[model samples]
Target: MKPHIVMISPALANANNGNWQTASRWANFLRQRHAVTILPSNDPETWSSIDKPDLLVALHARRSAAAMEALRERYPDVPSIVVLTGTDLYRDIHVDTSAQLNLQHAGRLVVLQEAGLQELAPAWREKACVIHQSAPSLKPIGAACKSRMPRFEVCMIGHLRAEKDPATFMQAAALLTSPGIRLTHIGGALDAELAAMAEATAAAHSHYRWLGSLAHDDVLHHLRRCHLMVLTSRMEGGANVIIEALMCGVPVLASNISGNRGMLGEDYEGYFAVGDSAALAQAIARAAADSVFYKRLAEQCQARAFLFTPEREEAAVQQLVDNMLNSKSTNRNPFP
Candidate 1:
């Protein structure tokens, strides 16, 4: 019999959140060789189900702290792995009480980006590991996307929230009214104030559009059609969108935060300080107008994209699980 594992995350089954994607990916990847179940948070009693997992891998420590605590109490002997998301690292690790407790609760912690470690205390550092998010294999669009008009299209993908800084993209749109560049945001607004700002910013800039919550395929279609990608997020846990963009070979102009910098090299030329709309405008303008600059960004994106392939990610996940279960012995029953 396969060794059992339980996966917990704050995301609902149908939600499009990154954490949801992470959980689903892990479960699907590990299911072929392991007995895995996604732990639902609604019932603590469900924790007592038969075939107790050998390992518990929970994502979003800060947001799912209550669930984490309960599981820790319920399965004190089983190894519990906590996967930290962006809010947990850049935002909650500093301010959230439950997030702090999560660090102490888990036997192991996973951060999607390497730079996230710097923010943690030295004692907790030993328990954390960095795993880059994976991207789907490229379908390789046929038509070359040479822009026919002066209007350069850029897409930003993230749920609209304060930490995502959708407003920074909005602010840059206000400054990008030169008719040479167009900016469109793809995300559901989790913050009403940010939504209003996005609406107002779009209203003010004719070249800007806020597309609230696109279907995954539609978002990928938009990404393939656009000229460049931009992420003005205040914090991130290694955005899967960046990985998608890299695989799409779309150039990115992102905020100079650890998550974005970690993905795009330390010296990647396409960075602007967080909330720097004026600077972002300059980066957008460069990516839109200068072919040489655009080519450089595209080349780099392609180079890094190979690191995010499906096989590579599946193997990485499988290896981690294999190592986690390496010491455990499983039942050899032929029939039950």
Candidate 2:
């Protein structure tokens, strides 16, 4: 019989966030070799109804803490894996007891990016491994194909939350001087104030439009149609949007943070300091106005594209699980 695996996720398909995307994709990948089931972290009652899984995979250290604890209490020998997110790595783990405890209890820890490994404690680093996210490649749509008016379209993907730093994107839009340059924001407003700000920005900037909560395929379609994508997040545990943008052949202008640095190497020319709207605006203008610079950014993103392939991620995940199950000792680290 195939080993049964239970995955806990804080967000579901309805949320349309990075956590749900990771959980959904990983579950699909693991299901090829194992019997996999995904349970929402919010639903504790449902967790108890199912039989104990051979292995437990929980996304988010703090949100899934209760589920991890319950599984540990019921089946102490069942090895658990904790996948840390932006909040867990950059915020929660530093101050939240549950988040820290989850790291201590997990038999294996997974960080989406290499830089994320640095956030882990020295002791916990033994079992930690990096699993970069993946997205299917889409044919790039040139600007001419997207619009006949010779317009340069840029997009920012992520919900309107303080962590995502939508304000920077909005401010950059306001600073843009080129009438031919259009900015599109795709994501629902998670914070009311941010939503109001988005509304106000859209109203003030004729070139900027905020389209709330597009479907996944629609978002990707919109993404591929754009010349560039901007990521202004204050923190990220390896953003799936970056992978999606690269896969769609769209270059990125990202905030200079460890997570973005990990995705686009340290030397990538497209980084602006975190929360620096002026810098972001300048980078955007440069990419739109300078074809040579834009090409370099595209090439750099393509160079890193191999790391985010679905095949590579699936193989890594399968290998990690196989290693964990085959080992007789729980302390044996699965990742080399």
Candidate 3:
């Protein structure tokens, strides 16, 4: 018999964000061997309709705290998995009582990257595990298709939020001296002031274009076509975009945060200091001007592609669910 599992995500399809993507992907993975249902919110009424899931996987600690706490109280035998987000690890756990409480209440804790383990308190460390997100490989465009794009096109994918540090990308765009290097940014303007900054920067710089919020399929197409990708987040639990870029054989220039470093190995050469526009500009110039350096970055990223394969992720999800189900102490009627 298959275990019945429920995944609670704070983000829905409309959000088009990482948390939603992760929830959707995991549900797909688990469905092959288990019965899976995904819920947008963790409200008690929503969960009560399902009676009780064999296991509960909640994304975002603070956001889903109420559902996780209530479910744990009502069904103490059911195992709960709490997936930590970038904010939870970098900010919320340090200050938010609810997030901290979620950690204590969880049966198992999941961190998206290795560096996230460092953020957890000692008591929770033993139960926590790192699961690197996966993205399917998209074949790069052929030379004929590539010829249509400008000389060196770099794409950045992230919404306009303070933590994403789009300001640094805009500053780097202004500092870039190479006409051949064109920058394209794709994401929604979550903040009005930041949206204004993107518009102003695009207007001032001939090579810069801000293409705000794109469909997921469109984003993957752009990723395969671009010569390089950039991630400027100040913090990340693990970026799915980085995985997508690597799987597509595209190199990346990321901020030197633990999340980026944890995905791209510490030895990976393409890095710029967080929020440092000058350093980012220099790195972009180097990547565009030097063919050998660009090749090295691509090769290094390709070497890590095996780590994010679908088969590995699927197996990991299956094992976690099986372990949780087998360990359930109380007897209950099996799902049909």
Candidate 4:
């Protein structure tokens, strides 16, 4: 019999948001072999029963703690894996009790990027595993396709949030003061102050624009058309946007952190200190104006992009689930 894997997440699989996208993509990958179900984290009735799932994959431990706790109580010996998020790794684990508890309950812990291993306590380090997010290779866009671009646009792809730090993009735009250059931001703003700031920035800056919450395809299309992609995150747990940007043949100017550095190799040259708009702006100018430098980024990004492909991610997930089931205690194995 196939093992039943329950994937508990905050949103549905198809959601345009990063967490949803991750859950959705993982489900698609894991479904090839195991029976997978996507359940809302807050679903109450399921918790009332002593249902034993073969494996429980819970994302953002803090966000889904209630369901996780319920599952742990019902299936004390089953493999329960906790996938950490940016906030959980870089922020919440330090202060959030629920997040810390979730870490304690898990038999196996998955970190999307390599740097996450350093964030764990010494005792928990042995159970941690690093899995790089995957993206499918894009059919090469012809050189002539480049001529269709009417402007040299610098694109920032993320919702307006404190962590994403969209204002840094605006500040960089203010510093650019170039006639042919423009900045386009895509994603919904959760914080009202950030939304107002984006509106105000666009109203005052002729070359700056805020494109609020676009559909997945639309955002990808825009990314494919842009000159380069910018990620100004204050902290990140392996952002999917960087992978998406690379697959689209877009150069990246990202914050210098474990997440970005892991995606773009340690030798990658395009990085600026987090929250430093001036330095980010300078990097952008260099990429746009210097052909040699721009080529270097594009070439390196393309080389690293294969690690994020659908084929690779799907294979890795299938293998992982198989290993978990095959390596279980002899008493739990039906044939044994």
Best by TM-score: 2
C-alpha-based local distance difference test score of model 3: 0.86
lDDT of each: 0.79, 0.90, 0.86, 0.81
Residue 311 miss distance in model 3 (angstroms): 0.7
Clashing pairs in 1: none
RMSD of each: 4.2, 1.6, 3.3, 2.7
Pitting candidate 3 against candidate 4, the one with the higher lDDT is: 3
Could you arrange the candidates by lDDT from highest to lowest? 2, 3, 4, 1
- Best of the two (3, 4) by TM-score: 3
Error of 1 at 335 (Å): 34
Considering every candidate listed, which one attains the maximal lDDT?
2
Off by over 4 Å in 1: 41-51, 140-143, 328-336
RMSD of 3: 3.3
Better of 1 and 4 by lDDT: 4
In order of TM-score, best first, we have: 2, 3, 4, 1
Candidate 1 lDDT by residue in tens digits, 230-292: 999888888889998888867899999998887887878888999999999888887776789
lDDT of 3 by residue, 1-336 (tens): 777888888988988999999998999988888898887664668866677778999999988888777777878778788999778788888899999998887878888888889889888888888888899878867636765666788999999999899999999999999778889999999999999999999999988999999999999988888888999999998998999999888899999998898899989999999999999888898988787998899889989899898888878777776766766744432211
lDDT of 4 by residue, 130-203 (tens): 77776666654554676466777789999888999998998898888555777999979889999999999899
TM-score of 1: 0.91
TM-score of 3: 0.94
